[model samples]
Target: MDRRRLLTTAVLGGAAGLVGATALGSLSPEDVWAAEGANAKINPGDPDPNFVEGRVTAVSDAVVFVTSSDGTYHSIRVTTGTSIWKLNPSTLDEVKVGDGLYARGVRMPDNTLAADSLWVNIVNLNAHVDSIGRGHLNLDHHGQRVVAHVEQGRSAAVYNNTPAVSDMSMLQAGKHVKVIGAWHPDTNEITISTVYAAV
Candidate 1:
């Protein structure tokens, strides 16, 4: 198999085994986001009581396109003042093409949404692989220590002598890794997405 297929098999297999049989099916970025939206907690006081949850369809330097659960789409403008998970764009991995997102913001007069905060709590993390082992890896990211689970289906690629796993590998223990998966607030564990090693 090619590198992408191998990595997909490995990550999916690892997630299934680790997360349990209930989570065995493959999760598209949209699928993961949709599930999170169903359970998302919405804070009251917004003008629009009918506010909806959505996933980011696209992101650019200044705007984000959100597709809501009801099949409605909106283009939300992202200002520098917007509250994202990570302050630095380089460290921000919460919102990608396919990610679960909860956006709470104001609706503009033009019918577009102006998001104050875009929560991608359900998205996967991206990180670089600093070290690898038989069934686990240690990732260094954002001044934090993260542990990742490796399984039989997991694959690896070598970039400049550093092993890159799936997006989760971005959490290399001593290197600059970006995490883009879900963050377990209680345990602080992040389910990984993509890991990009600094060039």
Candidate 2:
């Protein structure tokens, strides 16, 4: 079995086992994200109302400060329940200064977002697999060049509505793919999160 899959499944199963973990007067970080997300009044398909997307300018314990592209400032608070995803499901330690983040949660009266989820360096793009290398993919996204990295155990492929598979051998040259990934800041490069193919 894939190690990444095991890690994710274990975390999710642990979260399940922790049910009423809160009732015991304590909850895990996984529980926090589940609980907070369940409580928020969110509009489906619309960008999260209180979502904040920015680069980390500072990190002080559980609080991370960010500056958006438009120069607006936002403070996002990470909790035990908040889910943090880097190239894969990760922990807060993977988050660092200068990392880009997309946070979804409740905006407190004090202006800090109590984040339920944080997707660090995440991006979604529609591109053509222009070429392939031993461990990389050259992509053309609307005429823009992008280099997509292949992280073993982390990268997967989805073909024709089927489940994603670890083998990327089916990804042929000149094919179009909808890719979700972690975009390297200020660069055309991205570490693929998932690569979905139409045919």
Candidate 2, residue 49: Cα displacement in angstroms equals 4.3
User: Model 2, range 23-108, lDDT digits (tens) per residue?
Assistant: 22222222333355564566776655577888999888778899988789998876655667777667778888889987766666
Clash list (residue pairs), candidate 2: 29-80, 29-81, 32-81, 33-81
Question: Each model's TM-score?
Answer: 0.37, 0.75
Off by over 4 Å in 1: 1-51, 86-94, 121-199
Error of 2 at 194 (Å): 1.1
Local error of candidate 2 at residue 115 (angstroms) = 0.3
* Total residue pair clashes for candidate 1: 31
Q: Model 1, 1-199: lDDT tens per residue? A: 1322322333334322222211222223334344544633555543343243666688876567878777888776544334554212222345677655665445555665554445564444455456765455666555456665443333333345465554333334456544445544445455444343554
User: Model 2 has how many clashing residue pairs?
Assistant: 4
C-alpha lDDT of all candidate models, in order: 0.48, 0.73
